[model samples]
Target: MSSFVLVDRPVPEVAVVTLNRPDRMNAMAFDVMVPVRDALVELSNDNSVRAVVLTGAGEGFCSGADQENAGRAPHVEGLGRPGFGLRSLELLEDVVLALRRLHQPVIAAVNGAAIGGGLCLALACDLRIASSTAYFRAAGINNGLTASELGLSFLLPRAVGSTRAADIMLTGRDVGAEEAERIGLVSRVEDPVVDAAVEMGQRIAGFSQPGIELTKRSLHAGMAASSLESYMPSEGLGQLYLRLLTDNFEEATAARKQGRAPQFRDGR
Candidate 1:
């Protein structure tokens, strides 16, 4: 295992990759991201491994891009790809996308305050299992980071409703695990992400690898056909669709008369 991952003893055939920077709240640095990407690729190739549980160490699952290396890409000496300026930081996002291509299921263990890119990290997983202590917030609006740096904007709306994504992104609301569960943002809420991930991974691993991989491919491809678009279309179309949904006069009337929040079923 690379230093970037605090590899736990395999839970039978499952591999748990932990972001090792506990002191920094498991923040991403260039050194870390590079190894993490490699670890993901390396682990995927290991025939002994059947599933992946990705998470971080300490009180934070991930705080987003490392402020120090915010604008840089990760590269080994003498290896650089042209036109891939954002590839270093975006490597993690690519790793997330690659999860669907793997023969095993990828589960996210979101244990703490996951902000900015951290939320995107969780979004990349096929299933997200958050701890009770977990809280989520978007960084693009609150901080100066672009929403697309990770996969936040693209994944958020689908995880929640697009309108809720707008409300969460524009307002930068810190969503706790209970509400996250209610909104279907998290598959389950457990005390620690590792336990949650392992429990789910065991269940998912019971399925045949090829069949599981195919299922993952179909699910992500659907998202790819939609969520992988550039931020402009994603943001604009999301807002437009949301506005159209909210424009239903009868629903609005019912919501007002009921004295409760509007219940828009086809939210995202």
Candidate 2:
């Protein structure tokens, strides 16, 4: 827990991860995530580490994947290992699951601009307490990336509502900390993410472990993954799977390129 990741293995098992790449606004690269996933797994398993807090070292939380790494639509491939693959999206899922699977408490101390994948970091936390200056954004849509990618597709709606999630994520707009609180995306509004996270950690540490763990699981258990089956598909799919089956996908992309709203051919 102390080596690969910066660890302060104190009582109640409070571990903090500084995204460590403030140089590019804490932009995430493969190297950064390896340590991040390692940190998450290490702290999660250590019995002494009862709680975990994630934050960035610089001015931003995380800004998603390295732009140089971006490429075509998700296509799975095996990385030679049985379960491990080199697919970018699959690894993203791995990171998300690692955060979710941890029995110990996890919190996001949003210190600054949590944009793109950075915003997803906040979403990953069991609770998010943002600094007054923190910003929540979804820049993926602006780059032709799916907001659904990086678990945002599933997490945002649960934090807010399906409609509101779509509005922000699809529009690639930034939401302020106050607005995040207003829309029910965050639990606290304050500065110094580490301090806020530690305060919450101390409070929860007073509780029994199982009770805390179960409550956390129960709270987050069913969130994520938009099942269009229950949704009214008339609105939009963000050029989802169905759109790619025909020329409508091209139409949707063209509209976005033209700086206009997508016009799906099917009225309903």
In candidate 1, what are the lDDT values of residues 1-268, reduced to their tens digit? 4565676745887888888887777776666666777777777888667788888888889887677644345453465565454456457666656654566778889989788778877887788988889998887787854555466777888889898888888887799999999898998898756976887787766544544555676666566673455434544554455456644445557988999655434333
Weakest ten-residue segment in model 1 by summed lDDT:
226-235
Model 1 score (lDDT): 0.73
Q: TM-score: which candidate is best? A: 1
Supply every candidate's count of residue pairs whose N, Cα or C atoms clash at under 3 angstroms: 2, 3
Q: Supply the TM-score for candidate 1.
A: 0.75
Q: After aligning candidate 1 to the native by TM-score, how far in Å is the CA of 262 from where it should be?
A: 45
Q: What is the lDDT for 142 in model 1? A: 75
Candidate models: Cα lDDT each: 0.73, 0.72
lDDT of 2 by residue, 1-43 (tens): 3232465644445777777767766666666766678778877
* Residue clash pairs of candidate 1: 74-88, 162-268
